[model samples]
Target chain A: MAKVYDAIVVGSGMTGGWAAKELTEHGLDTLVLEAGRPITPAVDYVEHVPVWEKRFRGLRDRNAQLANQPIQRECYACDEWSSKFFVDDHENPYTTEPDAPFLWLRGRQVGGRSIMWGRQVYRWSDLDFEANLRDGIAVDWPIRYADLAPWYDHVEEFVGISGEPLGLPQLPDGKFLPPMELNCVERVVREALAKRFGRERVLTIGRVAILTQNHLGRAACHYCGNCERGCVTLSYFNSINSTLPAAQRTGKLTLRPYSVARSLMYDKKRTRVTGVRVVDAQTKHDIEFHGRIIFLCASTLESARLLLLSATPELPNGLANSSGQVGRNLMDHVMGGGARGRIDGNLDKTDTGRRPNGIYVPRFRNLRDGPKSPFLRGYGYQGGGDREHWGRGVDQAGFGADFKRAMRDPGPWHFSLYGFGECLPNHDNYAELDKTKTDAYGIPVLKINCRFGENERAILKDASIAAAEMLAAAGAHDINPFVENNPPGKTIHEMGTARMGRDPKTSVLNGWNQAWDIPNLFITDGACMASSACQNPSITYMALTARAADHAVELLKRREL
Target chain B: MDRRDALRLFSATAALPAVPDLLVLGRRLHERLTARPALRTLDPHQNATVTAVADRILPATDTPGATAARVNEFIDLLLTEWTPQEARARFLAGLADLDARARAAFGKAFVDGGEADQVRLLIVLEDEALRLKEQPGPHPEPFFRTIKYLTMYGYYTSEIGAKQELHFEIIPGRYVPCTPLSAASGPPGGD
Candidate 1:
């Protein structure tokens, strides 16, 4: 009775956009349900706007931050420049344990977090895929680098990534655009890491989703350096900026903004997802849209919440969650640690514009084919050297004309190295539906209980030591390095709730990202991650979504339903 | 956030923000009519004292300093709108301490005192504020440190100080990481 589309993708974020593009290009009519407002980039994207032009003079509204966005305020992107990209924490409340602080920084908009992503794109290799199985902790990932390599090529070809080739087996090279040049300090750090520390710890220009050259009708990055705010030139890869527009060009896509997908309608007798139950964001009324297949790409925790909230009498625990792993094994990258120091003699040097990219030190611990280290997995450093601005003016000794003269010369170029370590998936670190909490739309919210494990703390300590060593090797002075294993989910790389694995008994989704029990339902977002790889996960999500969409279309054509 | 350059805002914002005072707006409007831009957060005496302190912190020479850049107005605006009540209270108390010490020494208000008197009082406050050894005051940093920091922050970030003095472009379209300071323009432009 309802308008039945070929497929329905819940969410319009990173994976959702990819799914839409892939499905529509494959000639399967697809519907994209977004819970947030349609992004109007010209009006919304405020890149390059100077701080002095802002109403708050680049200062975030403290009242709004303190009252409504306490959690969101914790994010660097939640500043005066692009706070709109983040959700007000009050409107989208989630509970966390008193001791374990889990930061769920989300943007409920058409572009979703792709509009506010770090844009760092890294390829996960066999090292990550084999970690869980080798350690005998979680179920084995059904597929490995070989299976996802082509998909990575497919996504990278479309999304022009700007990076250098490392040729490392654990970190494979992708179809890349011209890489941006490293600064003087970054070059020094890279050399020091290579010559002094050896090839185990490799430093290269960060592999980023931002384009160094034009591709796919999108202009190259002008290097204005503000990628977090929406890019008008389509320089970086964001759904609203890239894939969604491509999907629209196909005309096989039906984009329904402000359609908050509540859950998938599971047909028990048919053993397939019949449709998706959505709530109109404005009207606050439930509506149903039938689809032959459904893709749940509504981020990690949200996708898990959708299933946990849809627990039916037939599937008492949760649909497609026969393994009882629907809302379990939550993991995020262990962050909030590293070291920084002053780099003198670069006084004449200045970064004219913000380089949207930074230097990256690839994972060096517990490496591939090498002797096992103290930790199971490893961590990588992502930071660069830059000159400090007048914000340092306050603390500098002296004032008046002399103080003014002192500020004329910029502060010494400071080199910092921060570690983004892999967070091991612990069964106890999980999120489930909070019975007490409901969002503005009256849908249940998540109650997260995620924290960094012992491995994370140890890795952070090692990362700090390594970062300090690299800085020193680079001839850094007044080096003050620190190691703090911050709360989980702080990096915003939350994953592994509906992890894909070989066994149906141990995992919710199969290698194809299809639920083992519900053949017609697929999840290819962070929820589909089998393990929390050290690299940024967005690129992987894009690859997996494109691959899964193609697989879904093949299954449909075969009349498998 | 710079690839995680210790996003730890070691400054005052790292601590729990103090409650905002409600009377801030009314006082803000009153100060506007009294001063050129009027002060919202600081009273007449406090405003005069802060203006004197800011001017001394960055007095005018060949280049425009704190007063020319309206650093006092900037401080007032932040105190009224942005500064948390606890920090604002400590700041105002710090200004009062400067005035009280000035009176105790010179038998006149800080603003009423000679340039030398203001400089001497500021010197003593500077010594008192040096306990933190800089690094943005570990936040709620004692009063003199906070005021001095805010004064410089307001000055250099203002259009006059940034565009006129240091001379960096707000938006340089492309990134040239190692350009000479005098080759193309002044110190690479920032907010």
Candidate 2:
């Protein structure tokens, strides 16, 4: 008989790292199975590498990306020094409709996409949790803001977010360190918005996971600007930089890299997950690891894929998916709608370091007390002010010794406001297992069928108009308002595959993120998200994982399994 | 511990020392001592023409310019590896046409012309590039614009251009959101 651990988490990314840390600190023997190679910051980090050393001088290797990473190249983070963090398109194949193209950007390493995740953290309030119920669009969320408030506090205290307290109800405030300051043009725009729109429209520095000062033995940021390439100071909150180290400090944790989970082993009589069936990524051999309880933190689509692959005779649709909702109601943030303008007065001033964070405009549309909007939910803007650099010489006409000298100085400051709007849950937009096509490991791949609807487009249009109005009010010149029709999953906030709800017939997971049908199984990743808020979802996933780990430990102590 | 103590500990460990790898350094030194990287695409005359044209486009001022940055070698590398075969052929044809025009005007090759004559020729090319831009039909990028853009890209990304001209620091230890232009050092690299 194989020795069984107290718990097993089937990922080492954002939520997986939180689960590992929480479980092991609770004195449970936790096993973390990572699907990719281990990451060593000293060896893998390229944040400090100079452009003179690179072959292409920061213009990415286009031929290599066109050949190997056709889909992964869509992400801005998949550049010259950091493209190695992304997955090869040939090995991890997925299908989409011919018309509805989807870009499934993935990173198959120990830290997963957390290594390149945009570190914007915003707390979702009752506006998001209660949207589905108020609009009667889909199933209602089982829990509300009050239920997750303490969990948010729990994770934010450990995560060390740096942000200002705006006291807005739609976007709640979290435990924060000293906030980053706004730049010259951003301060001008903020003052203008305050003067024109009053209390409704406000601009604040982005709440990021980067450190302004040292916390929990990790060094503060050196402001090198490229967090996607890997931070050498462990300043930003990548799992390899922060959470996995904390999990390793507890001796109860065992992390295994290159262990791709295939499915969960279900015991029919006991109605509990017995173990996980995994494929050894190096040797292509099947292996098993038994645990008393299992946590599926293998991202949104991957967790849903695992559940759908584990269909047994009793649960023919999928394990713990008696509700027929394992792979339905998929959603991602609808983004790429806003405006930009040139702010001309700040030529005498400039910023020194490349601060990785930007300014944020919280949601102002369709507040409870505010005027009604044409859309159901609202959107937020994330952008910043920057003086034009030497690259502006490409368009500037004159070229000589004088032109070269002119290019050395910073040009006029320009401010932009890019919006990320909320995406509604549609039952037609979902993923199912494409049995005809398989990945390199012979596991079935997901065939995603998702697109934006009318409301999402309306929200984006409103966002562009509102952004232009604000910039015009700020006395900006040459204001350009634009709306781009971005497809689903481009924002990489894909969730709502296996959502949480009060009714077991409608949702796969309960309020505690435990599967309603399977007592010993839980999913605390983005898969348990009942709705897709406009904010970045990684912090919420972290908070939910910690809360679910605490609940799992309590159930174990009670001998429930 | 106090903030100063924390800063000291962090700078000691996390401000990773820029220690060069001995094996890589040894290999690079050996290569440098033995031979220069052979030109893969441009011939002797073509390389001379590119060097002259790029120098005229961005001449040496108080700071080092395109020639000092080895921008011709960079363009040669891109032509060899990065550009497609059709684009490479088009660029070579454009180079031949440029020599023809130079000979037609100054009765000599472009590289052998005087600095003032070279500037006049570049001004003509810039006017043609602009004329082509105002047209409506889909046309290939003018060769002057391509070489000019490449020269700017290569020079600014070079070590002398980045460190000496732009004063790009690899590690800015602190962030000052709003500082005077005189107080700020320079822009950071790879922004």
Overall lDDT per candidate, in order of appearance: 0.84, 0.89
- Quick one: best TM-score, which candidate? 2
TM-score, prediction 1? 0.93
DockQ of each: 0.37, 0.47
Candidate 2 pairs with clashing backbones: none
Which residue pairs collide, candidate 1?
A400-B57, B12-B139, B28-B40, B31-B38, B31-B39, B32-B38, B32-B39, B168-B189
Predicted structure with the largest DockQ when compared to the true one: 2
Residues A1-561, candidate 1: write the lDDT tens digits.
578899999999999999999999999889999999988988999986766566566677888789988988888888888888888777789998899888899999998999989999999999988888889878788998999999999999998998999899878999988888888677777777778878788888889998877788998777666778778899998899889989999999999998988878888888988888889999999999999999998999999998887889878788888998988999899875689999878676666666787888888788867877787798888988777766676665676677767777777788889999898888998998888889888888889998787888988888888788878888899888898756777799999999999889999998899999999999999999878879999999999999999899899899995
Q: Report the C-alpha displacement of residue A13, candidate 1, in angstroms.
A: 0.8
Candidate 2: misplaced stretches above 4 Å? Answer: B1-35, B188-190
DockQ, candidate 2, vs. native dimer: 0.47
Q: Model 2, range A345-367, lDDT digits (tens) per residue?
A: 87889998889999999999988
